[model samples]
Target chain A: MPYGYVNSMKTRPGHRDEVAAILTGGADGLRAAGCRLYVVGLDAADDVTIWVSEVWESKDHHDASLRLPETRAAITRAMPLLTGEFSSRETIIAGGLGVTAG
Target chain B: MPYGYVNSMKTRPGHRDEVAAILTGGADGLRAAGCRLYVVGLDAADDVTIWVSEVWESKDHHDASLRLPETRAAITRAMPLLTGEFSSRETIIAGGLGVTAG
Candidate 1:
């Protein structure tokens, strides 16, 4: 099974556009790094909360993408626009799951 | 700003209840580690997809919780019932974001 990661973060008020731009600019980099699926969704009621779902071929591939200069730069640019601290966890894919196949 | 983490994973078919049990069993461990808000929400249309949102006092606290034996055991028990791979990213909290006080 392919490894995947879900990253959710809340943007500072009025900074949603800036945050979205940062994410969009780095989409290619993520795709080039073997990201099969990448999506950014906003909370229906609160525009500031953004959730990102990404699927990579493997954890190594995902790690490699993070080391890319472009990815690093994009995150750096987004730092100031983050409203609350973000956290994440690494999980192993153990059957019976599927996506829409992007 | 409070550091929060969202961990999303998909359960094996017909394993939604099991997944929730695992999560519930570990709730105390998370809360004891300074997790202010911990919620497990299943996708509206898909019961297999589960999303967990937790707010911790800091990343260190979150990290500490992960290192605990209970947390490790809980995850290990849930591994076999996992359907798809999970992914996560760490982001810094850099203003204007608020959550409903718990």
Candidate 2:
């Protein structure tokens, strides 16, 4: 089964866009790291909150991605912009349209 | 851009599978309704919460889907199995792997 999560983060005031950019900046690397999906979304109702929905081949793939140089750099760039408030729901993807499970 | 959200719902005790079944039962109809993705995921840390990640061609398409007979019926059937606890973050999909935005 694919590992996935919908994670929410609050960026420091006036930094949501920057944080979003950092998150999506490493998309190509993530794809190469076995990411099935990596979506960055701006919260419709708030300026400081961003939502990231991701699906990886496995939890190991996701964890390993974070250790990649580019991924680590991106996180460093985004860390300062974040307010530290976050929420996440980790999941075992069951499958649906546009997603092929292994 | 595609309209999307990561929605979480808590099911009544021991009804998670039933609720998940109801959510995915109308998958075919959702595709015809312009849904790009509709992924059902089981929370890794809990048995009662389910996460649904969705992307629609537009918000209008999503709103219209709620009125479909199958959708309405599913909602009705699943309602009793739910705890009324929900959390969602509406989004405008920027772009990502596996999701084609309009």
Candidate 3:
């Protein structure tokens, strides 16, 4: 089954741009690690927030991505900019454009 | 450009199933109106919450979707079950799976 994660995070005021950069810059790396989707978005209501929607080949791949040294490095760079973790939702992809139904 | 929206919501206790049903049940209608992605997700932290990730052909298409009769009906049916609107982020799809970059 395809695994997915949907989440939003709030950074300190003025850190949104930095966070977006980090997230996007890390995209190719994530994709190389079997991430099918890594969408980076700007919150419409709050300028300091960002959203991420990701789909991975499997839940195992999603978990394994975190252990990659490059990912860990990116996380370290981004950790300081975050003010709070807003919310996260995990799902099993049923079927859609980017994913195949299992 | 491909337009996207990522958001998560909290429903009144015990209302998640109803909300997911309404959202997914209306998927075909949304697709008919040019919606390319409509991912429904359940929150990991809160059982009563849900997440939605949507992609439309254009920002106009996304806006026009709200005016669709079926879309309006679904929204009306869902409004009562919601407890809070948590977050919404709007994005220009740069490039990724499921979308072609312009």
Candidate 4:
């Protein structure tokens, strides 16, 4: 079906390189508003615990790429390196379970 | 604060009932294993896509819960009702964005 969005943010310990440089400057505006997959992972023994896996081609192009504006300034510069309370949810892939392709 | 896990599974067009049943069955096992929050939601427009939000005391707790037979069986039962694909990821809550209480 091709609709996906998994966003998990939890970064604090040492900032994780300023939240991966604000998620690589919004990752080309979320791949030019279509966003195939923009990933940022860090949690090898903590690092504040940040995880984002996004693949969008539906749900209205992931809600119009979160209203662009470079995805709201890369979430306002990652909201001050976060310490413990970021959450996100949106998903619709509906097939089975197969995600071992690194 | 606390660690959490978000699991998203997309179901078939007309299998929401069956899917929900399986989830309900496994709810206790999860809760008994120390799960704090376990909520399942279905999209308004699409009935196939499913999303699950889980809050655990810690990563270790979450991992251990999966080892429970009840948890595994629930997943296996829902496998057939799915249509597109299913994926999940875990994260730590680093204070920043706050979810509106429901």
Candidate 5:
């Protein structure tokens, strides 16, 4: 099974757009880092919340991506704008339309 | 843009599989109701969490589905097993793979 994670982050008041940019900018980079799917979306109900839905080859691939310099830098940049409240649910994707079983 | 929603529902101790079944069984029903894509995944970090990521033709289509007899029936069947606690984030999907913009 592929590793999937739904990460929800709350951005400080007007910083949601900034945080979104950081995530979107890193999207292509993530694809190069063993990511099968990476989606960055702005929550409609609340302007402060950002959602990142990811599908990776493995949990190790996800962890390794975070350790990369660019990934680390992006997180650092978005941290200051974040409110620190988040709902992260990591999952072992069983099967899905775009996901390939492992 | 397609309307997208990420819903994280919690199942009581051993009911995750049961809830998953209901979600999967309703997958076809959802498509019949204008669901462009529906993915059900079980949380890895926690066995009780079920993540449903959806892409709809419109938010109205989603709301309408809930009103459908079959969809309502499935929801009722899964209710008893659900913990009633969930994280639902609705978004305006700005262009992602496999989604057709409206």
Candidate 6:
């Protein structure tokens, strides 16, 4: 089954965009690292929250991704702008439209 | 800009699979209704929660889908299996991998 992760983070005031940019900047590397989907989103109803939704080939792939140079760098850049208040969930991609475990 | 919605719902004990089935059953129709992506995910660490991630061409398209016959029927079938516990976020698709507003 494809591993999924959905998370929301609160950025420091006025830093939401910066965090989002940093997150998306690493998308290219992620695709080659077994990521099937990697989305950076800005909360429509709030200015300080950013959401990231991801689907990976497996849990191991997701864990390995965090150690990649680009991924590590992106996390470093985004961390400073974040408030540390976050919520996340790890999921198993059962089945759905526009995506397949393959 | 594309509209994004990520939500989690708790299913009554032992009803997670049933609820997930109901949610994904309408996937075929969602694509025709302007849904770019619709994912039904089962919590990896929990058995009773299901997460749904979606990207729509526009908020209007998403709203209109709620009125579709299949959608309504699916919701009705799934409601009885849910526990009424939910968490959701509405977002703007800033940028990402494997997805585009168009």
Chain B, TM-score, each prediction? 0.81, 0.96, 0.93, 0.78, 0.94, 0.95
lDDT of 3 by residue, A1-102 (tens): 678898778898888888877887776788789888777766666678777788889889999999999989988999999986687768866554434535
Question: Over the stretch A1-102, how does candidate 1's per-residue lDDT look in tens digits?
Answer: 456565667888999768866775566667678775454544444668776545667779998988988888888999999977564444333311122111
Best by DockQ: 6
Better of 4 and 6 by DockQ: 6
In CAPRI terms, model 5 is classed as acceptable
* Least accurate 10 contiguous residues by lDDT in model 1 chain A: A93-102
Can you rank all candidates by DockQ, best first? 6, 2, 5, 3, 4, 1
Reference-based TM-score, model 3:
0.72
lDDT of 6 by residue, A1-102 (tens): 899999989999998888877887777898899999987778999899988889999989999999988887788888889889999889988778877744
Q: At residue A91, what lDDT does model 1 achieve?
A: 36
- Please write out the lDDT profile of model 4 over residues A1-102, one tens digit for every residue: 446555566767788768866775565566667665544544444567666545566678878877878777777777777765776656544322221111
Candidate 2 chain B weakest lDDT stretch, 10 residues: B93-102
Residue pairs whose backbone atoms clash in candidate 3: none
Q: Residue B38: error of model 1 in Å?
A: 24
Model 3: native contacts recovered, as a fraction: 0.26
Q: Which docking class does model 3 fall in?
A: acceptable
Clashing pairs in 1: A4-B86, A4-B87, A5-B87, A6-B87
Candidate 6's TM-score = 0.96
Fnat for each predicted structure, in order = 0.00, 0.73, 0.26, 0.02, 0.35, 0.78
Candidate 4 per-residue lDDT over residues B1-102, each given as its tens digit: 345555666777788868966775565577678665554545444667667655566778888887888788776788888875876665554322221111
TM-score of 5: 0.81
RMSD for each model, in Å, please?
13.4, 1.5, 3.6, 10.5, 2.8, 1.2
Error of 1 at B69 (Å): 44
lDDT of each: 0.62, 0.86, 0.77, 0.60, 0.78, 0.88
Looking at model 4 chain B, report the run of 10 residues with the lowest lDDT sum: B93-102
